[model samples]
Target: MKEFIDYLLKFGDLNEQQISCITANAVETELRKDAYFAEAGKVVRQTGFMTEGILRNYYYNSKGEEITKYFVEENNVVICKASFDNEIPATSYLQAVTDCRLIIFPKKNWEEISGTVMIWDSLMQKIISRALVRKVERISPLVSQDATTRYLEFLEHYPGLANRVPLSYIASYLGITQQSLSRIRKNIR
Candidate 1:
């Protein structure tokens, strides 16, 4: 809860009443490693503020292979806005790569809060805009970079995650085979 408040405060000021309103609808959940916060074909009904651990968003490609799309770590918010906005099922899944603690706001209440609280909508916009920009930045690398370069870029961007995340997931994230990631690791060493 503190983490959520602190993160939002970075984007905009929140008074006690506004904080109370938002917190009133927020719920805390814990997931063991490998648990999923959301799954494909289900509607994503909440926006989560990750307080602890990491999550990966993914989709199965046309070949039925899981392709990792993005990572959400502590202090990050995870939502499938396309689904959330349209009130439809999600096309991807959000799974915990590590045990996680999350403070989440229900989508229905979030809508109301934006109207009730000053700057809530602005804070949300700032948060979502930042997330969109980050999404674009992460996606842009995959098409332009080779596997080894992608791995290096991943390390450059998320240095601490390399050891914590499984090599298989990292390989998927880099759009490379596990054997390829192993070779890259060997070359780096």
Candidate 2:
């Protein structure tokens, strides 16, 4: 819980009162590997603060294959924002790739806490900004770079993702075929 609070503080300068409110209604849970934190077609009830382990956010393609969208590592927030915000069914899935230690807080609780805690509002803004920046980055090189170059850039940004996630998932995220990804890796090596 201290670690989760520390992470929140890193996003903004938070006072003790705000920190107290943030931690007040939170609950900690241990998620085993392969657990579904948030699933497609289900409304997200809680947003998680990952103290440890890896999580993947993905969506299904028309063919029903799961295509990885993003990976959240330790000290990151894991949520399906659209589902959480609107209380609607999710289009994406959130899953634990490793056994995880997480702090979970319901959206209702977060709203109540943030309503009183000004720092929490700032924290949410910062998080949104970061997500936007990452979206820009992911799309930019796809327009300007070759597939091999894009693959290299992906490695640069997510150093261990290729090794951590399955090859098919990584390939789908790269917008390339698994065979192409393998070729790119060979060329890079």
Candidate 3:
């Protein structure tokens, strides 16, 4: 939970009692590779802070193909913001790309912490703002870039991630076929 606390500290100040309450409300959990942290059409009951491994946010396209939207790696928050905040079914899925360790807070406990902590809402806002900016920075390039360029940019942006996740997922994120990604990888080598 130290990792999670450290991440929170980046956003706002927290006294020892506040930190203790936050920690007390959180539960440490593991998600196995290929497991869904939150599935499409289901209400997300918990929000998590990733301490290890990776998760892919994805959704099925009209043709029933999975399209990876974003990746959440260590030291990041993993939550379907709209769904969690509104208590609605999620439009996408958060799946473990690798076995993951996370500190999770159920909706009730999260609310309790928010109510008890003076700076909780402000801290969350800062974190969310940062996440939004990061998301835009990561995704905007893919819209105009060619497959090869997108792959290269992905590597540059998330070093070592290409090797850590399945090529199929990377291909999906790049909006290219796995075969094309393989060819790109081969040519780059």
What TM-score do all the candidates reach, one by one? 0.95, 0.89, 0.98
Q: Candidate 3, residues 1-189: lDDT per residue as tens digits?
A: 999999999888899999999999999999999999999999999999999999999999999999999899999999899999999999999999999999999999999999999899899999999999998998999999999999999998888899899999999999999999999999999
User: Against the unseen true structure, what C-alpha lDDT does each candidate score?
Assistant: 0.89, 0.83, 0.95
How many clashing residue pairs are found in candidate 2?
0
Worst 10 residues of 3 by lDDT: 154-163
> Following a full C-alpha superposition, what root-mean-square deviation does model 2 have from the true structure?
1.9
Q: List where candidate 2 sits over 4 angstroms from the true fold.
A: none
What is the lDDT for 126 in model 3?
92
Q: Which is superior by lDDT, 2 or 3?
A: 3
lDDT by residue for model 1 over 28-136, one digit each (tens)?
9898998888888988888878999999999999999999988999989888888888889899999999999998878888787877897887888899999999888
Write down the lDDT that model 2 would get: 0.83
lDDT, model 1: 0.89
lDDT, residue 172, candidate 3: 95
lDDT score, candidate 3, position 109: 98
